[model samples]
Target: MHGSRSGRHRSDPGVAAAAGDSGLKPKGPSTLQALTDLVRLVGRSNAPQLRLRLVGAVLLTLAGKALGVLAPLVLGAAVNSLASGQGTAAAVGWGFGGFAVGWALVRLLSSTAPQLADVVFAPVRSAAQRRAATETFAHALSLSLDFHQTKRSGSLSRTMERGARSVDFLLRILAFNLVPTGVELVLAAGVLGARYDWRFGAVAVVVVAVYTASTFALSNWRLEHRRTMNTADTEAAGVSVDALLNYETVKSFGAEARSAAVYDRALGDYTRAALKANSSLALLNMIQAGIMNLGLGVMAVMAGFEAAAGRMGPGDVMAAVLIMISLYAPLNILGFAYREVRQSFIDMEEMLKVTRQTPQVADAPGAVALAKDTARRGGSIAFEDVGFRHDARANGLEGVSFNAAPGTTTALVGPSGAGKSTIVKLALRLLDPQGGRVLIDGHDVRDVTQASLRTAVALVPQDVALFNDTIRANIGFARPDADEAAIWAAAEAAELTAFIRDLPEGLDTRVGERGLKLSGGERQRVGIARALLADPCILILDEATSALDSRTEAAIQKTLRKVRAGRTTLVVAHRLSTIADADQILVLKAGRIVERGAHHELVAHVGGEYAALWRKQTRGARART
Candidate 1:
């Protein structure tokens, strides 16, 4: 597609109006903002080579448009000279051949110059797209966990994908095609007016104005249809990815047909919306073509009359008609360019919204890393009157306070909704308490950089989500610089050595998507191995052994006991047996700690929450046996 002579980003207000602004103004952290950043990036790059290419691109664009306009004039002049010449036959032949060659050469340069310009601008475009994608992706990742919890994986991925591609499209269409096409239009009109009758230029000007106006109007109207289609597309993609990711659940529940039906409906919605958009596009194209051809016919008629009256020659008539034809050449993509420009803006706008998001949890200004000596001492954790609430949940932490001395174990166990997970999250600085302070080694976690805090802490969750990669890569992810021997040691410590050695590929075995290829016990072991590889001062196990079978659980628990030395450990376990030996067992009720003591002391208290839970579990186990 193409654009008009006016600056679409500034002069034309429809695009901006459609986006609830004016002319896809390079404002906000949107596509236009990306462009603004791109310009600043190029200027700051200190690479004169890129600047030279940019300048070369501009010169070539103008040179291409100029040659295009001159080519038709040369052809027309040749025809006029041949007809009026009284030269010898050989002279006439030479004159005809010379003009033909000259026209072809001009035409060749016209086409080649634009292509060469694109080649010159390729690096700039690539860099712009790469930076935009990297910036948005990094920003999204940096956002708080709450943001990700509410976002659909498929929809977010699609947005980032489309937005990245949009950067490339916008740069090309805006810089090379639409912007230059508009310039070419003005140049063509000026040439027509200067070399021919004033009426010819007037016709060219009116045609462009009307074309640009109508195209923008129709494209603006078409925007809703595109949006509708995109919504459906995103929904369908989200549904499919969600269902596939949980295919095990779907099959276990016998919901395959239901899932397929849902996807089918989503696609049906998308198809209808796409059809409407495509139909609107066809209508716009027809209108554009009609307007362009009408102007051409009018120019030809005027030229013909002038020729008949002997005011102009045959060559002038040909040149007059060809000028309008050549004008339509780049203007041909008017509708497509305007439509895509708006759509790309929308896509990039969505992605940029992510980049603009303010993380609920951010490091305090002038935050510093944890003291190495303090971290080496196992990073003491103290929760002083910490409070947090979830709007949707009935239970939340309330003045929760505890201190885990360095190199000791503190266990939290309670019924569901007791906030064990919330405490874990707070301790990791994944979330900040709404009130009160969470401190590590007497320094408020908020006062230190998150990176440093995380470096000293590691958590092994109940369900470990792993990347689809080799066992070696997954285990080594926690310590990217860890050598092969370190990885093997960690794996061996997690009791994964035997199982991994049994596999044909050993550490090289692929762990499929989300590590689904590995059994729950195996995945848990890999998670433990990864956490172990970090060699963190503080270790958090949130039901880390819940996925393992009884035998594996016992083995892992033994491994954990051995590895707990010199590191503070926080364990949240449903199976009371696993944490029975913890130095301190805090029994939580609702969101508050109701009982705090050693396991033996808590079990000694008759009818106490911990004692009751211990009896119930032991009784159930005896009954099952």
Candidate 2:
């Protein structure tokens, strides 16, 4: 079946192939018509395989309904035969025998249909779920880094999971629940009209119509409640993730109680919303049960009268009553199925919104590929009148421009909130400069492919994040195709091979979530090893050894000299001694460069901020000793 225009398909047939021969536009339908349109809309795909499965299901359902109607008629015939006294024993015996067989057949089919439906629908449901998840994740990853910075990872993950599950729910409703219910309704109406009179059919139709209307109305009203519950649940999840990630900090401050209180507030809101939703659902169920049985009572009374007046035979009356009760089985699921479908629609809308979001940092059309270049032969990095500001921030960097020649280490030291990281982020194209440009090897960063640009640069972040996997796997992530020898060499250069070799599993040991099993110094070494494996032309150490012990820091400092020998390196650090041997140091304050000189030269300047920072660090180091 084809989806609606709102859910556009890849292929469109000619206008002549549409429902209208004149090819005129089709107007929107009324609510009842719209419901029919929804079924047609869902059926528009017209997949031959799906059609065949649905056809088979419909045939099975009709057979089941026919048997169901037959059982009651047979039982009523036995009663009539006993009343007539024409070989009553023999007549009753045959009638009951036939009824037993027919009843058994109906019961057997009723149980088998769901199993058959699942077998047929599983592939379609899985395919739709896969499509939805793949698209949602791809779209999220494609968005600019700035967009990601503002969103929570846990929340995004939850949205993607919910969206994917929604597709499965929708497919099951459409393929199994809703479709079978529709078929049952049609069959019941036809049998009632033929066996008894149009009045019986009218009563059946009215009850179903009222049941459907009430279901829709109640579901629509509950939508806001569900949405509120979702919001509260998301907030609760986000709070827990945030707290757990910062557990150490919370513990350090002895604020566990405060954190728990915050979480409780979110959970409390969630509980209230959940209660409201469930309560509303219960009320709907209660009302539906009352109305449906009342309608059944009315139909049963009419059927008795018809039999007494001889307008319909006793068997016909019994068949009409039996069909009505049998049809209620599917109708019972109809209410909950409708609710799920509406919920699925809401989820689909959210997923589509995310999927349709255009990436802000998309590559220009006809963009050229970036060519690989090693540090041994790579050239200088430069920025020209670059300016940037976060969408949420009023100011970031303004007209900042600088250059670091190849075979030199440029250290950027700054006060807190000085936009030093912003410069790095912009140069790496993680955040595009609103004005001017950043160039690497004389090529504009935006002019070349991101893959090529990233391949040319490597970053070792201050807070090194490692995967929960083998030590070798984490280190070799930068170069997945690297051999064991290459991995060992990189680890040795980072001064970590000896420690890894001593572990129980050597390099194959599991890291435990975010490398929590490893010490701070060890995690830092792993980060360095990853960067060494990458061997990018431009290397960035953003306080790479900050978490290490002083002894380990001193050791890694020696490793850094060898690593930066031929590479263009940018070091952002607060510890002045770490960058004392750098080719140049840029001191920044309030988003602008305050001073630029060698460390020794900057130290010699009496009134410079770098000189004061140096004295303060020297005093602190002496106190620690």
Candidate 3:
């Protein structure tokens, strides 16, 4: 039967070929597309009040710029009044007073506008950041188990953090800095053209054009270095987190030096990339300074020539120089802003990669909720010719069919790779069968909502993972609203009451990361207690007693038998002794059920697979004795 199963249930070449595609590679959209998407994401917060605030911010920006531009003109007029021989002392005093007041007021408005804009837009920026993070996180959780398995947790977490921060930075730069700077540039050019010579305006335009072109060219060249640095940084962080998470493994193998070497190598790569990026940055800054100073020199020399030629006054030169100086502030920021903006786009694109992955499993539109009351007795489960394949090389179930009647215990005994755990996951709807249907209480499992279905079933796996929290909290996780009394009752059923009472903090004791603070048997017992607390209609024990000692196993077996009286139980066991008395025993080999019957009936069949397995175990028991 096993040989026939393999031949008849070969996986399709197409499905097997695509099984390893995890969608982690950085295949980001075009720059234009990314910018458009980011803009839309920021503006998605459709608050009418936010729109009003945005308008107010824009108005303040324009008013501040106008005031700033008018200040230099007033200063120039005061300088002209001082130079004029026909002007009286009173006129000079009035000119000086007006200049001082204008300068102070312009500085006040220029500084005040951005601060007020920040206040008005604070809520909008925060909302956008929160929305982006929440949606990305929720989408990540909804993805299939396969994707999570292939991804590094630390790297994934970093992507989310960096991505959200990038969005906030981009919004602030575009709204308050980039747009306002452009407006200021235009106003400065207009003033030079209308109030001064057209040559002055042309010089201003040339300076800006040259500065912008040089910054962009250099920034684009530095982009590859930044990307390399980010990659190395992410890799180093992932390695450190992975090593720390498996600290015990490192200690046991005496591989601390090896881990350190790996980490150092990653850091070395990062160091090289960072040095290159910093060097490029210095080069960009030097070139930018040269351009700005050169422009100022040319403008000043021209102003002096015009004054000597009687075409302009000394005050006009002061005004031209002042306007250029004011323009310097925004221009300086423009270089930094452009570089950071490009890097921000890269960060956002990495996050978008995660969000773009289509979930392998999702609830169908208009899916109905599971009827909890229908399984009052027990939920009857059936696999109708179910099939699945992890990959072409890995063994998976094929043409496997079975039925567990309500209020009965069924045991599946199989070798290590016989698809026992796969069957369990399929029953839970964690992985949908590619070729067949799984049913609970005569209804298709996929037809109902996953949340409702999962609530009705509880599983106790071989390896129990616990949060870094208190024992009471972990147990109560199965049913968050469960009363303390109910929690104690479940603990008692799992034979964990005495253990808890002996602890210093009792139920309040903290379980270290993944419950490493507890022994193997203790963790398994806690898992059993949590499952029992749920009071699920169907209980699945996937090698649940594998870690227990002989004595603890016996005790747990007794508890299991007592619990099996009302609820339907499905046991996947490697220890044949644990399931000897199960109502029905299915012997699986490769991916097929080669033998099926009561334990005694299968063991009595001459030369059968079950009999051979029973003899092997019996001989081993005698040898141990």
Candidate 4:
């Protein structure tokens, strides 16, 4: 029943409270203030989500306290009547029966209210958590490509997963454990003072004070140990995920024993940390038991003295004893609850780090939409003395200037790590240049919207990535609304239509993760088909045909020639044969362009870098044949 409602609140809150204004301060005076701040955050736009559950939970708590106070009084009355030697069985029986009913109400109200809270707040918590995850993921997508290049996928995934799950634990502690314990504390103190003498009330006060202090101290000790445990668990999870992802590499190198040794170290750390946490909790429980028993013993002796002096009746003793027992039950849980609340804060902090981040790229106020030019002069790319570097590195590209006129092919030829890819990335606006500007059709890329920029360019990567879906879906990814005929036309142009048609399910066959079901050449062709379907103004091929055989590479090159009539095409290739007929080729070395000219002219300069690369590539082709 609770799960049913949780599924209903999955819609995104369209109007987000401005990001990072949650006003969470670590320097709070009391737990109450911290809880209030957290509640205010979760309830910023949707006031009803917190208000309804909070009111219901408080009312239920009052109901439980009221029943608890009454049950003890009834038990006291029955004991007094019997002690006074009243010759009335009906009266005593009625007293006992009333106590039973009151006890039942206490149990029902306390237990049922928390369960109801879970049902009510479950949906709201889930929605908030979903919003947080989506916002983080979208922010990551908008971040500069250099940020992604330095981070590990497995670690990032674990961080987000744990951060989202933290909300559920926090809600449960707030709704059920924290609220009820507070109510129980107030009711116990009130009952002791009202019905018994101040001495007895003082006993209740001192014992409760000591119990709370002890719980706090022991819980803090255990919390430190639990933090260690959590670290070990995260490390273990990271190692396992990394090993599983690189299983093929490990197997090829016969590193099974080495992998096992690493996994065992992670597991050993986790086990040691867990054992320390459990042992500390067990010690804390023993202290709690000792304090509770001693308090009860003192109360028992005091009641006996009062009875002997004829100042207090047997009923008073019964009432005092029952009240103490009732209070002790919740007190027992307080230690563990405090520990959990502390752990929850650690989890919450991880989530806040992601939510509080400001994305490097955000749309400016009143930003202009990018418009494509279809006049006689259209689809041109220009780089004006651009300089770039990753945040952690000193150099990526420096003082580079270039232009690709409309309706022409500009090829960049360079060895690996020579900044050829960086130039292509700059043209696609994947990363903004640190020192200069990239212009598309005479408009700065930063001045336009991200959606418009993405729509204006299509990139074919060296390693084409495909989702585990139908072949048709993978090819039509650029334009999901493309009709069957348009998809078939693009596939035909890329020379992939015949192979797709030969499959039993034709285009419906599942490609599997990263297109594992297809060969390297087939995946490259699918990527080309996707790019062709988009038909963007600027096309980028970054070693797009490097994975194919000579024949397949020649076929794709011929197809590209026909499609390059009126579009700006930028090619980054290692094979000189692929770009031998390009209108112009730029040779790059160590983040600088050392040579730029027609291919034949570059080859004629025997000392030029492009000429050396062409000689090496041609020699490799001869050896392969």
Worst 10 residues of 4 by lDDT: 9-18
lDDT of 3 by residue, 61-140 (tens): 77776666777777776677667646788878887778777777777877787788788877778877787787789889
Candidate with the greatest lDDT versus the true structure: 1
lDDT of 1 by residue, 271-387 (tens): 787677667767877888899888888889999998999988899899888878888877777777876776667667767777889999898899999876443558789999999
Of candidate 3, the 10-residue stretch with the lowest lDDT total is 10-19
Q: Write the per-residue lDDT of candidate 4 for residues 1-625, one digit (tens) a residue.
A: 0111111111110111111112232221245754663564566525355667666755765665566666677667656766676557887667656765665665566566556656766666776576556756776666666667776786666556655565566676666656666676677777777767778878887998899899899877765565666566656666777787777789999998999899889778867876676677678888999999999999889988988898789888878887788778767777766655654554455545656666566566776878875652338888888888766556578888888888788999887878998898888877778878889888888888878877878999989999999989998999999999999999998999889889999999999878978898999999999999998888899999989998888898999988877778899998888888887898998788899999999999999898898889889889999
Query: lDDT score, residue 137, model 3?
Result: 93
Task: After the best TM-score superposition of candidate 4, give how far the Cα of residue 583 lies from its true spot, in angstroms.
Answer: 2.7
- Would you give me the overall lDDT of model 2? 0.74
Residues 302-418 of candidate 2 have per-residue lDDT tens digits of 988987897766665666777777777666666566655655555555555677788777777766766666438545778898887776776678777788898798999988778
Error of 1 at 182 (Å): 1.7
Angstrom error of the Cα, residue 486, model 4: value is 3.9
The lDDT per prediction is 0.83, 0.74, 0.81, 0.74
Q: For residue 97, give model 3's deviation from the true position in Å.
A: 2.0
TM-score of every candidate:
0.93, 0.84, 0.92, 0.87
The deviation in Å at residue 404 for candidate 3 is: 0.5
Question: Model 2 — which ten-residue stretch has the worst lDDT?
Answer: 9-18
